[model samples]
Target: MTTTPSLSRTDWTLILSLALLTFVLGTSEFVIVGILPDIADGLSISIATAGTLVSAFAITFAIGTPLTMSFTSHLPKRKLMLTLTAAFIVFNLFSSLAPTYGILLVLRMMTAVVTGVLISLAMLVASESVPTGKRGIAVSFIFGGFTMANVFGVPLGTFIGQRTGWETTFLLTTTLGVIAFFAVYRVVPSQLTSVKTSIADQLRLLTNPRILIAFFIPAFGFGATYVVYTYLVPILKGVLGVPVAWISPILFAYGFISIFSNMAAGKIASHNPIGRLRFVFLIQALVLAALYVTTSNVTLGLINIALMSFMAILLTTSTQIYLIDLAEKFNPDAKGLASSLMPVASNVGIGMGSALGGLVYANAPVMTLALVAGAVALVTALLTAVSHQLDQR
Candidate 1:
C-alpha cells in the first residue's frame, strides 16, 4: 500500500495553484454562451447547432472522468495531475488555434475530458492533505476558483471574445493553462499515493447507493442550470431583444453575482449542509421558473440573470463538501473514486441539461428553455430532499 500524502506548504500552494487552473478551464468551457452567435456565424452553422459545442463538452465530462481516473488511479497522483494539466493546457491551445469548426469541436471535447480528470484529482488532493473539519472548506475553496471564474474569467473572456473574436478567449485560456502548469509544478510536490485496484474494482464504488444518491443531485441540479445557460445567448438575443454588444456585459454581470453566491454558499454550508443546500436548490428552481415570464422584459431578464447566476453554483460547492464528508466516513479507501464522482454527477447534469435544452428548442420557442430548466431543477430539489432524509438517517 502507498502511504497517504501529508500536508506540506507545498500542498497548500499547489492546492491554490490547481484551483486557478480550474478557474480558467471552467471559464473557457462555458464562456462561449455570451458569444455563441459569433462562433455560429464564424463556423457557418446555425445557432442551435453551435450549441452542441457546449453539450459535447459536457458529454465528454460525463463519460470520461471515471475512465481517466481508473486508468491513472494507481500512478502517483501528483505526476498524474501535472501530466493531465499539461495535456489540458495543450488541448486549450488547440482550441485557440483550431482552424476549422470540426477541429475546434474535437479539441473542446478533449479539453473537457481532461478537465473532468483535473477536477477529480484536485478534490482527491484536497481530501488527502486537509483535516476533516476543514476539508469541506478546502474543497470548497478549490471549487470557489471555478465559481470565481464566472465572476472574473468567463465574463472577462466573454467581453474579450465579443470585442475581438471568440478565438481570443482561447488564447486567454491557453495563457491561464500555461501559468497553471508552472504553478502546479512548483507549488504541488510530487507525492505519489497507492491504489492497487483494477478498473473493475474502481467501478464498484459507483455501486454503493449512498454514492449514487450523493452523485444524483448535481447531475439533475446542474443539468437544469445548463439548460438555461447553454442557450443563454439565444435567449438574450432572440427573446429579450438584447443587442449583440450588450450580451457580454450581461454575462459579466451574471458572473459577478455568481462570485458572491459561491462565497455565501461555502460560508453557509459550513453550518447547515442539508438545509443550506436544499434551500439553494429550491431557490434555484424558483429563479429559473421565473425566467419564463421575466425573460420577456429585458430589464427583468438581465436582473434575474444575475440572481440565477448567484443561485446556479450553490448546489455544486455544497455537494462537493457533502461528498468529502461521506467519503471520509464510509469509503476512505475509495477517495479518488469519491472525489471524481462529483464531476461525474455534475457532468451527467450538464449532459442532461444540454440535451433537454436542445430537445426543447427543437420544437418550441426559446422561452420554453427556461421552463425546461426550471422543471429539471424542481425534480433535482425533490430528489435531493428525499436523499437528504436518507442521509440524515
Candidate 2:
C-alpha cells in the first residue's frame, strides 16, 4: 500500500522485467493478426482455419485465468510468477518449433494457459506495489507493456516475418521469454501471503453484480474496439485500397496513438473513472463513425484509424481500477478474482468483437463493420452510466 515498495530500486527492476514479459505475451497474442496469412500458408491451411489460432487463445484465456487464480491461490506470488514465466519460455519454444498447424494450436493453447497466470499476477503486483492513490498509475505502467507490445512488438514481429520469416518472430519472442524468466526471478518480490480458500468461495465472490458489470464495461467497451482492429489490415487493404507496404505503417501510427491514449486514460481515470469511461466510449463511437465515411480514401482512412485506436482502449485502465476498488470496498476477499477477471473479460471482448465482425463480413462491406463497432461503444457508454447510477444508490 505504499509507493515506497513499488518505487524502490528492486521494484523498478521487477517492473521492467514484468513489463517486458507482458510485451512478449502481448506480441504473441496480436502478431497472429498480422501474420495470419503467412501462418496459413506455412500450415497449408485456409485463412479461416488459421484464424482459429486467435480464437483458441481467447477461449483458453477466458477459461484459464480464473482457474489459474483459484488453483494457485495457495502458492506464493513469487513462485507462481516464476512458474508461469518458465511455462511461457517452454510454450513459446514449442510454438517456434511447431511444424504443423495442429502442433501450433497446441503450443498456442499452452501459451494461453500460462498467459492467464502471468497477466493476472502482473496486474496484482503492479497494483499492490503502490499506494492506493497511486494504484491507477502503477496499473497503467504495467499495462503500458501490453499497449507497447502492440506498438513495438507486433510491428517488429511483422518486420521479422517480412524479412526472414514469420517463424523468425516466434524465435525472437521465445528468446525474449527466456530473458523475462530471469528478470522475474531476480526482481519481483513476494506478495503478502493470502489465506487460501476453496473455489466455491471464489465463485461466490465473482457473482456480485457490480463486479460482473464492472467486468462488462471492459469486456464490451474494448470489445467494440477489437471489432474493427482485428481486421484492420484487411480493411486497409481491401476497402481503402492501401498497399501491403502501407498497412504496417498505419498500424504503427495507430500503436503510437494508443500509447499516449493509455497514459491519458490513467490521468482521466484518476479524476473520475466512470465519467471518463463514458467520455471515452463516446469518442470511440464518433471516431469509428468517421472511419466508416473515410474508408474510400487511404490517407483519410489512416487518420481516423489512428484516432479510433487512440480512444479505443481509453477505458481499460479505468475499468480495471474501478473493479479493484469495488472489490476492496465490498467483498475485500475478491480482489484477486476481480484483478484476474479483467483480462478474462478482455479476451472475451476480443472474441465477441471478432465474431461480430465476421458476421457483418457476409452482410455488407468492410466499412459497415466500423459502424457496428461504433454501436457497440454507444451501448457500452449506456451500461457505464447505468452501472454508475446503481452504485451511487
Candidate 3:
C-alpha cells in the first residue's frame, strides 16, 4: 500500500481548479432545467418535448462517459482535462448559435459526451492529488461546485435566459468554461499519473456484482430527485402558484440549501457511508412523498422542495468515495473508470427519471411526479439496504 503525502498549497490550487471546472460543467448540464420554458418557447416546442433535452443529454452522458473514460484512461490527466474543457467551451458556444431545435439538441448531445467524463476526471485528479485522509472532503469540494452551480450559475443563467434569450444561457456557460480552462491549465500538474489499464481491464470492473450494485445505488438514489427536479419549474409555477418573477430566487434558495447537503455528505462518507446511506434514502423517500401532500400549500411546498433539494445530493460523496475504494480493492488499476461510475449512474438516473416524468406529464397531472419519484426513492432505499448487507458480508 502507498501512503498519500500531505497536501501543499499547490495541491489545494489543483483541487480548487478542478472544482471550478466541475462547476462550469454542472452549470451547463443543469441550467437547462431552470431555463426549460424559455427554450421551449424559443423553439416553438411543447415544454414536454423540450424536457426531453435533459433526458437526452443525461442518457448520452450515462452511456458515453465510461466508454470515453476507458479510451482516455492512458492519457496524462492534465492534458486530457484541458482538452476536454476546451471541447466543452466550443460545444456550448455552438449550442448558443444553433439554428433550430434539432441543431441545439445535437449540440447538447455532443456536449454530453464530454461532461460526465470531465467530472469524473475532476474527481480522479482531486482524489489522487490530495492526501488519503482528506480524499472525502476533497472530492466533496469538487461536488460542491455542482451545488454552487445550483446556487449561482443556474439561477443566474435562468435569469439571463428569462430576460434576454435562452441562447444567452449557453454563452454564459461558455464564458465560465473559458475561465475554468485557464485555471486548470495553470494549476493542475502537467505530470500527474495516468492509468495504464487497457479498455478490456477497465470494462471488467462492470463484471463484478458488487461494483454493479454500487453503481446503481447512485443511479436510483439520485434518479428519484431528477424525476421531480426535471419539472420543478412548472411545478413552481403551475402547482405552487409562484409568480414567474420569483422562479430564480426560489431556485437560489434550493441551491443554497444544497450546499449544506454536499457538506454533510462529505462528513457522512468519512464514516460508515454505506450503512448511513440507507437511512438517508429512507428520509429522501419520505421527503419526496411529502411533496405530494405539501404541493397544495405554497410555503409548505417550497419548504418541501428545499428538503428534496437537500436530500437529492446527500448520497453523492458517500457513493463516490465508496466506488473508488471498492474499485481499488477489486480492480486497482481502474480508478478512472471507478470515478466515472457515480456520475454515470447519477446521470442514468436523471435520464431514466426525467424520461419517466415526461411520460407521466404527458398522461397525468404534473403534480403526480412527486408520487412517482417517491416510489423510486423507496426502491433506492431498498437497494441501499441490500448494498449495506453485502458490505457486511
Query: Could you give candidate 1's per-residue lDDT for residues 35-86 as a string of tens digits?
Result: 7888887778899988889878877887888787777778888888789888
Q: Model 3, clash count?
A: 0
Model 3 pairs in collision: none
Enumerate residue pairs that collide in model 1.
219-349
Per-model CA lDDT versus the true structure: 0.78, 0.80, 0.88
Worst 10 residues of 3 by lDDT: 2-11
What are the models' TM-scores?
Answer: 0.82, 0.91, 0.88
Judged by whole-model lDDT over C-alpha atoms, candidate 2 comes out at: 0.80
- Tens digits of lDDT, candidate 2, 1-393: 533333566556656777787888898788877788888888799999998898899899889788878777767888888888888887877777789999999889888878877888888777777566666666677788899998888888888876787788788888888888888887777755554777777667677887878888888987898888878888877888888888657767888888888788777766678976777788888888778888878778878887887787778778887877887887776577777887898888988888898888778877888889999989898889888888778
List ranges where model 2 is wrong by over 4 Å.
1-11, 41-44, 162-167, 294-300
In candidate 2, which residue pairs clash? none
lDDT winner between 1 and 3, please give it: 3
lDDT of model number 1: 0.78
A best-first ranking of the candidates according to their TM-score comes to 2, 3, 1
